[model samples]
Target: MSEPVKVREGAAGASDDKPGFDLGSGPGRLLVWLYGVFTVAAASRSVVQVILDFGRAPLAYVLSAVAAVVYAFITYSLVRGGETARKAALVCCAAELAGVLVVGTWTLVEPSAFPDATVWSDYGMGYLFIPVILPVTAMVWLRRSARR
Candidate 1:
């Protein structure tokens, strides 16, 4: 006689038996770590710039703050590891990509508009383009993780 495994309840009355997928495992772990790093980096940069010289490049500093928020949200969603979290991460990733593209283009088109470069400027040229590449990779991973 074998006993049945107990299934725990998750957030919003969802079953823990099938928690969508583990976003904190395997490559997703790397994504989470990278996002966490970016969150800290962007946040720190923006805060210092805003405090020291916000008037010098208000657009750039504000955009960096926005990037930090987005990065933090994605990091949280990845660690949460649920269907709702996955969807939210995917949407944020798309928005991140769009931000990168728009900011990169804007920086190139109007150099004077940004007295200082944002995290997304030149497609993250200052960061070796990781800012642009990360979101695409994350979206793919999030989509695949949902199938697991």
Candidate 2:
């Protein structure tokens, strides 16, 4: 008889982790890598904005920090994929969608309000629309990992 395919469990019962390495499994590494990138990006942007010229556009600068916070949340949630993180990802991604849409429209119709920039400013035109893409991908990722 052929050997049965063993359903091995991971160290923490991480359902989606592949064999050989816990962290190197499937989208796990990708998620980790992306999160690290976003964390650095958002942190740096916020730091530069606040330190260099917080007075220039207080509203936009503060929103940049908030955007960074949301990105940070998304990154952490993706890396720490679990039942809770999945839900959090959904929420964060949804919020990102709202922010992008609202700010995109605002920047389009009422350009004067946004003297400074944010992740959602100009419909993410500044970031080559990556800001718009991240949340959608995050939602899909959460759904895929949800089946774990």
**Leading candidate by TM-score:** 1
Give the alpha carbon lDDT tens digit for every residue of 57-92 in model 2.
877777777888887887776665566667777898
Best by lDDT: 1
TM-score of each: 0.89, 0.78
Worst 10 residues of 2 by lDDT: 16-25
Question: 103, model 2: CA deviation in Å?
Answer: 1.2
Compose the digit string of candidate 1's lDDT tens values, residues 29-138: 99999999999999999999999999999999999999999999999999988888888999999999999999999999999999999999999999999999999999
Model 1 lDDT, residue 43, Cα: 100
State the lDDT at 13 in candidate 2: 58
- Relative to the true structure, candidate 1 reaches a TM of 0.89
